[model samples]
Target: MDYKYLLLVLSLSVILILSTAQHENIPYEDVPDICAKCVCLTAHDTDKRYHHLLSCTSKKFQHILARWPEEFGKKHDNVDIVATFSGNNIELLQQLPATNATLTFSCRHCGIKYLQAPTFMDVPFIRRLDLSWNEIASDELTPDVFRGPYRVTHYESIALVDLDLSHNQLHALDRKIFEHTANLTKLNLSYNEFRVLNAPTISALSSATELQELDLSHTAIKSLSAAIFKSLVNLRILNLSGNDLTSVPDKLQLIGRSLVSLNLAQNPIARFTEESFIGLKSLQRLNISYMPVLKTIGKSVFTRLETLKRLDCSHNPKLVEFDLESLTHSSNLTNFDISYCALTTISLFVNVTQESHTDIATLAKPWPHLHTFQSIGNPWYCDCDLIQTMEYIGTEGDTKINQARCDTPYFLAGALVSNLSSQYICNLKIPKQYKAILEEPPRFLRKRYIILTVIVAAVVISVGVMLGFAIAAIRRRLKRDDFGVEPIRYTSVRSSNLSAFSQGNTNSIIVNGNGVANASA
Candidate 1:
């Protein structure tokens, strides 16, 4: 009976163990909280709007999302998940369902205050946030609200990779804002009022080991110091165009030497020296266009770029000439835009590259392997010298010199600006040298004195004609008996002429009809 009772107790213990295991292993399919933030629900609720953003299969935008702190909502009672309400709509932001909101963004019209301290939602694993065009001040981000920068999100765990805070009213850099974003790569603070980038700002960005691209375009940057970009080792592109930089900063060679594209357009660059791009060995595209004050380009400006391809220095007013003889070895350049510069003729770019997008040769002559040439707005003198260039383009049929319209020389201003076609506004004058020869004949000058001497001898004959005319007039007056009217004016002029003759030809006198000397005559 004892053995039988023990076996019944063992069976009861096995039954209890099996029941506990079943309860513990029950699936979470019935829980409403687990189903709340599922991908399917989030995707469906957002009307499939954020399908690409919510996608985790790829790491394309991983660098931009790592700016926000990891453990968000650690300090506040009401947690927030959705990042959309931070600035755009305060009423809607207050109504946010609030928990695990990873990303947030708003346009320029958002009225969010810049001084709002960091909330619990900012501490979580949230990665990306775009407050572009919002007039947010520089003091809003605090580490206490987000539990510091090193925190992480347990779900979909990954560091943020991208951040775009462009077009904001940020007047200055508060380095603490970026101190927490240690893992970010691409950062865009473009179109801001950032007048200066101090040492703290550089240090904060250098913490992000994966930074690759940084854009500070359209800012109030007066200068770019070497200390600002020293930490970003893997940087590929740095855009600082549309700023007030008068000179290209020194020691930019520290940007990993692998930088590809750099835009320095619309700056106050007066000259473009070859040393301006000394360190960038792997650079490809460079845009320094639209600088009106830029006057000269160093002959060796692009001598070092072996892999450099496209170069655009167009829309510069004072740039008169571009001689590409020194850059003949860099033949890989494909697209070149030197349009609207001070190029008077098409000879400026004879053979700069092997393959180009503009056909500059068509404007003057069929260039050797020339492509798209945007030579316009120069004082293109339409004359016979351009006919050779036109002939080459007409035969090759690939040169697009038709767009290189002449802008100066009043007659050809609006005309179809082809060098070969238009007859240069018809100058009808003879050659100046030939006209001078005709005016100053050697033989005529030699006989000039003789002709004057003969004219003086002919004056003796004129005296005889004047004497006869006077005698006839006197005879007419006697016939008509009209001597009362005095021919004072005629007599005075005749007397004056005779007086001059008497002064030179002395011993000569004028006699009246009765051989009486008329002293007045």
Candidate 2:
């Protein structure tokens, strides 16, 4: 009896193992009835339920006649359906099949050109629709393209919270295009051909009062209407990069109450006036990088940005002057990037006086809360003021400074600002009266002095040798006069005396007192 009981237990254990294995390796069922080329499966959701996922991607289908299996909702307990029909050749989106479950549809890169009216009439519960990377034009995007049929009294509105229409050929949208998507929270219109977002197009988006994020990048936008974004009161993030804007969009104060992150990069803006970013009281992150023609950030340009934290002005090749005092109002700045610009000094940050050419005893610290300061890739002129500023930054708090290498004062060129001392930087600038206390000159100056000393010594040695040779020649001439053969002397001898001299009479020849020749005689 005991052996039989053990055998039964072992058999049951083997059966349980086989069942678990079969469950784990169950093949995803194909839903040919809905989309001949699609696969439908139930995925475990975070809410402890299974949601239907209908994937029809990369199927070279021209159209889909979705007819969900009769028992689909019963099997999945009426859970949501996330459908993807991307990478297809569907030119017109007429309508989606009726379904009992909420839907999230994506048809990216579908070559879709037209969206027919009542496109979502049968599936009015769509929460997200992505039709990006299509050939849809402005004229085809009629106001009722996203509309559904009426329920009983009023028209049924879509539950759409996110809509992506990027990478299309749309230049202008109908004035009431978003009338059915009033619940939209995020809208992406990037990579379009909108050279100018006209007033009517801006008014069309007023119905989406709940929108928080909008992407309009790479749209070739040259300017914006004064009230373009005025109705988007809840907008938090706005991207206007890769445009042709010459200045900041006007009347940003209309959305100043809720705007947070703003990106204006890759534009041709030349300068920022004091009122450039005015009324942006709630802004935190601002990116103005990659502007080819930007040159100056004028004083108080960032005046009203008291809540600003991170600011990126990097990669502006012509950006030379930035009024650091303009950042005084933004004391909460934590990350500041000014890299790859044309800045030549850090005196603007340290508030150094050019007239005095002296370091301040108590420097004005602009960004007290700054933690990440990237200032590299600039033409930094390392001087007394720069050294002091860098020293103060290095010792104050835990701020991280990516110091720029020097580009001026030939001696300190290519040297990191953090590695230099005030003595080395001020060696050439110290007053002559205080030279006694100054450290040795920089290596380049010392090298110059050594070369100058060698040249002077060589010159002096040459002059001394020439003078010695001249003096010796003079002395030898005197000695030759003293001991060499004396000139023939004749002391006024008469003709008779001359005859006697000729006859070798020694007494007739008379010499001068100094024994010098008398040519007159």
Q: In terms of lDDT, which candidate is strongest?
A: 2
Candidate achieving the largest TM-score: 2
Question: What residue runs in model 1 are displaced by over 4 Å at the alpha carbon?
Answer: 1-104, 115-127, 143-158, 346-372, 382-402, 407-521
**Each prediction's TM-score versus the true structure:** 0.56, 0.70
Deviation (Å) of 154 in candidate 1: 14
User: Tens digit of lDDT per residue, candidate 1, span 1-521?
Assistant: 98987887777679547744643443322223322222121322343332112211122211112222223323332233343323223211111122344443332335444432233233444466555655666555333223222222211222355777787666666555554555677888898887887776665556555778889999888987676677777888889899999887776788737688888999998987878777777888889899879887777777777667777888898886554544454566655677778765443333323233134443443234445444556655554333333433333444455366654444455554554332322232223222112245566466887798789889989999999999998899787965567565545656755776778854455567997554542
In candidate 2, list every pair of residues with a backbone clash: none
Candidate 2 structure lDDT: 0.78
Quote the positional error of residue 79 for candidate 1 in Å: 20
Error of 1 at 42 (Å): 7.5
After superposing candidate 2 on the true structure, give the runs of residues whose Cα lies further than 4 Å from its correct spot.
1-41, 68-78, 348-369, 393-400, 422-424, 427-521
